[model samples]
Target: MKYISYYHNPRVSNLLRIVSESPGLTFTEIMRRSGLANGVLSHYLGNMEKRAMIRSKKGRKMTWYFLPHDPIEEDSIIISLRKETSKNILTFLLTKKLATFVEVTRAAKKSPPVVSITLSQLQDLGLIKVTNGFVKKYEVANPDTIMRLSEKIDSTMFEKIKDRFEDTFSYF
Candidate 1:
């Protein structure tokens, strides 16, 4: 007899529940929440995406997965900032208000390609904007949102842990 469907797998159901409750989560965040190994999670995520059960937004630093209709916005920016270099670049821009590419590279203390990819990712998320004039300068599009994210990043750990146990008990 055929095995029960993949959808019946506890891990897959858990993953779906996680995405439904907290859409726009990064792969690592999903893995952490689900307690899945990298290779296994990658395979399951790929299958889910292929079947269109979920959607993912790819970035230089992260890939955010969510239900197809969930809006990403601020959550996407949070994932980007989770990357060390991207966070440094954004932090620098937030302070300077606006700065040219060279200034950002210097401030981030990362090589051109690294800075370039980070900036591109930020631009893609609409978290930062680039203006074309004598030179291209980058600025944080929404300082308040980013400032809020920066403030809340460390504070969310307890909530995440609590949510894990909550989900565990939810099945009872």
Candidate 2:
């Protein structure tokens, strides 16, 4: 599975950082620190938990939010690609590394017009290089950059997750 860039999402990123730095914070505490409404915070927390970025323990009256020992990595290529292309196109690209226009349309499950526009936007961002032909070839550009960014993102994510888990669950 490829790692995506959900970390760039402000709500998710902030919650992870805060929980990692200070575990076992109640919903109120997280809201106070994060400056997010209870509903928004809860939504982000739920998404993170689904992603295995964090876990929760319910006590008598209070709920403690903690990070999981292992957090899943997002797809670096897809994340970066989305910055250049539409998310749908990026998802298709992930499944089909080098695809023709027709292939992208099929994989993206979008109309040809939409796929073409997205491909053009990505090409403009230099995220993908395209060759014109009966069957155009589209290749991912700056793979090294993507890899480097992935490493950086994963390192930061793991560091935060580790810190949160230790702070909340460690028996030292």
Instruction: Tell me the tens digit of each residue's lDDT in model 2 across 1-172.
Output: 3337878777778889987765556788789999998888888888888988888766567666767862323222333432323545554444345778877777667788877877786777676788778778876666455434434434463344346446654656
Query: TM-score for model 2?
Result: 0.40
Q: Mind giving the per-residue lDDT tens digits that candidate 1 earns over 53-121?
A: 899888777788878765555667666667689888877777677899999999899999999998998
Q: All candidates' TM-scores? A: 0.53, 0.40
Q: Compare the candidates by TM-score and give the number of the best one.
A: 1
Error of 1 at 15 (Å): 13
Off by over 4 Å in 2: 1-35, 38-85, 147-172
Q: What's the CA error at residue 122 for candidate 2, in Å?
A: 0.6
